[model samples]
Target chain A: MKPVIEIESISKKFLIPASSQGYQTLRESLTSLDFLRKKREFWALRDISFSMEQGETMGVIGNNGAGKTTLLKILSRITKPTSGKGRINARVASLLEVGTGFHPELTGRENIYLNGVILGLKKREIDRHFDEIVEFAGVKEFLNTPIKHYSTGMWARLAFSVAAHLDPEILLVDEVLSVGDAEFQKKSLVKMNDLSKNGRTVIFVSHNLAAVRQLCSRCMLISQGEITSIGNVNDVITEYTSFRDGDSPGTTDLTLISERKGSGIVRLTRIELRNSDEQVKGTFLMRDDLHIHLWLEAPVKVRNVKIVVDILNSFGETITSMFDSDSGFGLIEVEGSEHISITINDIRFYPGKYNISVSVISQILNHKYESFDEIENAITFDVENQLVNRNLTRRTGLLFLTPDWQIHKD
Target chain B: MAGYEIKPSGWLTFDFRELWHFRELFLFMTWRDIKVKYKQTFLGLAWVVLQPLALMAIFTVIWLKVMKPAELDIPYPLFAYSGLVFWGLFSSGISGAGESMISNANIIKKIYFPRIIIPASAALTALFDFVVTLFLLVLLILYYQIDVSLPRFAGLFSLSIMITMAASFGIGLIVSAATIRYRDFRYVMPFFLQAFFFVSPVVYPLALLSSDSLRIVLSLNPLAGAVTLARAAITGNPANWQAIFPGTLMTVFLLVAGLTLFRRNESSYSDLL
Candidate 1:
């Protein structure tokens, strides 16, 4: 029996504009010719080849820009590879993103047919599954109403429902379960689990390690556009976890980091991590006191300032968020520049790499709050395990806590 | 459905079988285009009929009063309205098909369909508007009690509309694909269409041009041939093979060129978009 998917030396090269300045792209389009434009070559996927058999559910885990999506795109024929070729022996359905072709002006019923057809399902099939799709989405009464009126959750649910009902021989899904309400996320995950159990070829690309471990029998880890590991789920995941470059630099010049989104009312200029001694450092031992020094510059007067820091695990799960207001210390004003020292008395995280996402928010009149600057994965640090307590040397949980125990025999 | 191979191919790849399989998608997309066209508008679909009807009325008054030409055998208003229907299909259809690719970038990036269908569906939305306006012509014909044979007019009507759609689809395919690379077409197209409208035999009949050279030059436009055929059907006049031949040839050329260019560039669309 032939494998459901086979490829030989598939590689994808992208020619990005040399100065890919978004501003120049639009302005130069009117003046310059296509051939005259300078472009820099970058390989998104490098000599990557893999085959999957029927009923084999493979999870593709990768960091951002790791070519996982590019691999899937090539398989799904959304984008042609720069070189090499591949063959699939069965019909393939790819959900690169849910609500792909949904138009806000279109009603839920209309969008279902539209999204269904875009996903390669036939009209009659959609008709046959119409009731099921509507029921699964649970927006039947509002089916005729334009989807613009639907809440974000409703939109995601309806989009997911249409995609979930698509029955194809091979499925290539990319983090579709990462959205929507928790219940809907579970429903789609269960549906995917059933798809694989029913012997359909599935390639799931996601950052959620737990879900990947649950739904995928085998796993592939990609780093810098190459497959670093592919085999047993736990082995691949362990290899992936080990590849994390945990020790980030002690300071980041926030002004130079252009990959940020906000109104820019008050811009963050620099961020530094220091130990209790105030010496600049990023790595820390468990239970060590840490100080996050944030330097801000406000060209204009900013009122009621707020600084928020979100601690995320290696799997992109938010462990907790710290806000200045939590200590009853916000509602400050800044004119030109201000240095903020957020002192954490005890860092109660277990040994692992954790990401620190920073956000600068402003409180306006009428109790309206808007984040002016927010950067996900702005800084990352390693938490080294220090066996302060001999009994808890082998930590099993993500948090380090000292709980008083009352010994009793029942 | 047979699975497809994913490899880079050169210039021409026509997958009629794939297109046949995606026929439902084409219909649905066309339906979506037609459905959402007038949403949130005060008049809704009434705008579709009103556009051509109003244009026909104004053109009728202008041609009759300003030109003050010698009387023709066909009624001026019917001549002008039918001509508008023919022109409308070519103009709006091409425009729709031309903008289809760039406008539907969301679906194009996420999924694969016959790239031709994007333009085809956009043109179909315009054709839907054409059909809505065609009803006005039928009314004019009934109101005038014009001696129109059903079968003969039907054949000519379908043939003319087919030619017009081909021309629009062909041009749309070229323009839409080109617009992806060079945005100049987005601005250049409106001027081209306005100029094309005057050049075609829409508001004025071919007979108005006394010189054969001018008449033949106008026939080079596919819409002129469509207008000639549609006029022949509406008035029960003998088909003008002399005027229709050149435009038909251009339509075939445009269709071939459009398909070839669109296919060649389609593979990289997701990236470019």
Candidate 2:
């Protein structure tokens, strides 16, 4: 079988300016002798090459900033590569983002037609699928109402329905199923599964590993703008997870991370994981006393500051969150540098790695709190159970419980 | 099944076959623009006629009452209103086409279609507005009792509108492509059009310019020729072939230049936008 999509040695280089100025005015560009010298080259993708068969369902898994979106854009023809060549033998439909061409002022019916045409469907094709789209979206009652007036869920449903009805030989989806309600996401996933089952090629890019494992027959892992592995779904996922655990589970530098969001008034300088002996450790036994230390800094004295810590499982889903206010810890006033520690006596996490995310919020006035700093997936640690008798299998779910049983005569 | 090769083509190589395949999208986009324009307004389609009629009223006060020019064979309102109709088409069409790509950056960033369709659809939407306004112009002619022969009126009116549209599309293509890279054009466009309004004979008769050289230079603006030819058709005055010829030639040149520049930059739009 021939490959439906063939990509050769493709590379894209973006001209990023060295200075902070986003764009230059026409006068400055014409008059300045240093105009050409000011720009630096940023290679978003380098010598990337891949090909896919006509009916294969492939999952593209990567960390943030891995150039996954750029690859999809090239395949969709939204942007062309700076070098090399590619070819697509079938009509391509890409859902880079849901509600891409949706206009708030247009009615739901009108927007369906608009989005359909934007997806490369003809007017007659849209008409043939109009009833199916409206019925599937369940917005027939409000078809004539402008989309701005619809509830957020209704709006997402309409957009997803319109995109789901796109009948192309190849579909390129990028994390669009993560939106909408849970039921809708499930329906979309099932629809995609059905499409692939009926001999349509699909390239799905998402952070949801479980969904990827479920829907894709093959998986490809990308790292640092290069494809590291491509093979069976299970093997690639294992390679990816193991690589991630081996790479950075030991330590994380807070200053090097630029993905954080918040005001710069207060900052989380560092985080440390320690045991009862007060020594930093990357692995722990089940039910061990886990101590988490946080270092913070503030330029001025701040009042009513709150700290929040979240524990996320291997799948990046938050298992639990610790808000200082939840446990009757009202607030702490900090002047400059402060060290805080929270210790849990009996940790119940199963034998798997977990990631920690931290955030700090300062209450400025009555009933008003501003996020000062937040770091997501800042650090990761592993948990191990030494007892062989204990059911330490990975399939025992996220929690390790201690139960009491008594024998009674019935 | 058709195979598509993804590579950069030569600057002058435009795929008209690809554009023909996406013609339905062009029509849908134009329809969407027209529907959205009229949907929110209370006056709806009435605003189409009211805009030019109101502009004619202002010009009548300024040129006819305040600064009276040479007496005309036709009523002053007919002359000014006819010119306003074509001028409205040119100005709105060019600006609309210029801003089309930027305003629809959401669609341009997400999907791929013939990039020309965005500006082309904008021109078509403007044409729709022109046709709607022409109905009011015909009523004005009937009200003034101008002897308009149907065959000559149809020919001149269609030719004049087409010329203005061609020029607008040409300018629109160049401006739209340039605006993607240099946003300063967005700010300068209004001022340029405002200055262009005076240079072209939109508000006054072309006869007011006494020197023959002056008329020739001004008539190089396609809108000047289009308005004069349209006015002459309605008023039954002898057409000025000398002034109209230069305008027609300039329109053709602009069309070719606009399409060439637009095609040269179309592939880079997704990156720049």
- lDDT, candidates in the order shown: 0.85, 0.84
Best by TM-score: 2
Each model's TM-score? 0.87, 0.89
Q: Which stretches of candidate 2 lie over 4 Å from their true place?
A: A21-24, A27-34, A243-249, A254-278, A288-311, A316-347, A356-378, A386-388, A401-410, B8-12
Cα error, residue B103 of model 1, in Å, equals 2.0
Model-by-model DockQ, in order:
0.55, 0.57
In model 2, what are the clashing residue pairs, if there are any?
Answer: none
Docking class of 2: medium
- lDDT per residue for candidate 2 within A1-410, as digits (tens), equals 78999989888888865553545567666766546666788676778788999889999986655778888988888888888788999988888988777888899999999888888777888899999999999999999999999998999999888888888899999998778888988999999999999999999998777889899989888765678888899888766655233334445556665446577568888778889998888788888888888888889887788888998766655779998788777556877888888888888888887778898887546857798788766677888887547677557678877689899999
